[model samples]
Target: MSDQPRSYLVLASQRSGSTLLVESLRTTGQAGEPQEFFQYLPSTSLAPQPREWFAGVDDENILRLLAPWKPGTPSMETPQEWRARILDAGRTPNGVWGGKLMWNQTPLLTAWADGLAGRQADDPDAGDLKTAIEDVLGPDVLLVHVARKDTVAQAVSMWRAVQTQVWRGRADPEVDARAEYNADGIAHLHAILEDQERQWARWFGEAGVEPLEIDYHELASDTTGQVARVLVALGLDPELAPPPALQRQGNDRSNDWIERYRAERISV
Candidate 1:
């Protein structure tokens, strides 16, 4: 209802440096808490498990490396309740709201939005994606597209994470030590990451929406600058952007896996 934008959404995929950007944004007290609010699966009420990523892959070798699937309780919140929680949880005292949305979780968002729409009105347009986002976050939400240029590196990072179940900060040395490099597993994630990026681009093109774009390398190297850019877009003070503190999760092992996967793919 205010003239200033009160909500912002980060459009990104797994292991794309989105966490770094969001965490930085969150440090600024003015910026609303930017979390991966849409990653949960309605059926499991949990973010996708490690084995779930390799669902169609019948490779026992790859399957054996990933953590075994564990069932989770389903979310019981109705559309209105879910909407209220997300809106409240993501907001700061300043009334600004922020959250992250991956391409894979769009279905869950749309379904929840549809349920809300059905309850609110009989209008057919209320169930659309744009309408859904507006219905929950208001009409002036700033959209930010955080992306990684290198799919191989992204996939390699994701492969390691899926194995360890540690997405942020440092992983346990003993637990991370157990993660093995599987070319097929990395390749599988590479394809998924590529497709998710492609879908974001295509959707933006089709919808005629031009979001503020952030590159992974640029974000990593100049995190404060990147966060300032988003704050500027949101009509907030750029000086509120916090200095970068989080370190990159990638390391020598990730680099080795990237090179190995490239070499194996080239030979095939």
Candidate 2:
């Protein structure tokens, strides 16, 4: 590895095929333990639960399909402590660190950064989303944006995963068997995801940061190649990037949902 920045973050929305890239990099044992570190909700101290994703819809049918909420224990760690833990957890033996962040989790990250500022004797220059990330990950971190062009398919995949609570691997047949497709739920996620992609674009424009862009179609089609690209961007040997280890989660049910959503959305 060259003396380039040893840390990187994957920026994406849910179901954007980011896991494929991060997990592929992780298998190489050179990359840091990349994870969705910012996805946990402050209230529950857990990754967004199935029902939490559908925040405002009053549709009982949608609610009933999702897994019931469990009140998770709130984290008691201070911002400094949380930062220390994350930094430590994400780092590799060679000091490279990797993590993933989503647009929706920006508020949580910023809030914790505020807490970090409060804990410091002198206030750190924590202001906006970009600054907050810099505060936590340092200024030299590489940003990679992974996005999916198919909003319907992405949202539909998310919709199914939300119901089954399985975001990885060949999903359990018993659990996924219970997951029902609802156009409204998928549409709700579709709007949120589309808006998130827009927000990422707007923020990138405003921040004047050109992140390494990874398209989902391309990433999914060439997982190892994409991982190699990221490794090269990080100034590491591209050969260290390993073969793809994850199985694609999309299936016939997901494709059907995507088509159904597109049809319904077009007619209405």
Candidate 3:
């Protein structure tokens, strides 16, 4: 095998079943850990709260809360260090690395990619986001664009996630919160999802990156087949036995929320 690492990215939007895809890839063991390495960007946008709320909290504490990975760990201080750490952590024993990035996180992704390529954060020569990513991760990096075909379902899922702030299940107990149906809120989320999809398309076109497009519905239906497809795309052995089933994350309230929104719209 070539000395260069085989890297790939799952390009997706919120509530697009990306977590499922990433977990499937990760379980393969041949595929590296694919996670939201740039999640800190979104955390940085957290709304300002009262000073008393964070009183006596150190910067490290704040970073630990905001960062996806354990903060204050070695090589976790600067963005560059974090990128290196993530890439190293994600690398498989076979030298394969995988990551998942959302379309809306362009700024953070660009900066991380630039750092990987040893360029200044705002380097103009870094080119577009795709180019920058390719520069660091290698030109042959596989791109998997996962999208949700059901816009209404995707929007409602995102809305509920935002409302409850419970994106995934953990060992810790979580307060189950049912999402209230708001036609206008769902509509706005739907529009944002549509716009982000368009942006991904435009970015792929401009960057001349031909991505393996996968749908959320199909992924949910036949996860094994979808994962095999991704493996094959990355020039890996598709004949290998599939990984164990991935545990479902989100609750099953999206469909009900969508129905309620439709009913409300019709009544309006």
Residue lDDT tens for model 2, 159-251: 988988888997789988999988889889999999999999999999998999999999888887899999998888899877777998888
Candidate 3 TM-score, true structure as reference: 0.76
lDDT of all predictions: 0.88, 0.88, 0.70
* Candidate 3 Cα lDDT to native: 0.70
* Candidate number that wins on lDDT, 1 or 3: 1
Q: Residue 165 in candidate 2 has what lDDT? A: 87
Model 1 regions more than 4 Å off:
119-127, 266-268
lDDT value, candidate 2, whole model: 0.88
Per-residue lDDT over 55-121 for candidate 1, one digit per residue giving the tens place of the 0 to 100 score: 8899998999887788998888998999999889999999989999999988778788878767444
Clashes of each: 0, 0, 0
The local lDDT score (0 to 100) that residue 241 gets in candidate 2 is 74
Model 3, span 124-181: residue lDDT tens? 7663686767655667788899999877788877766655556655222343343355
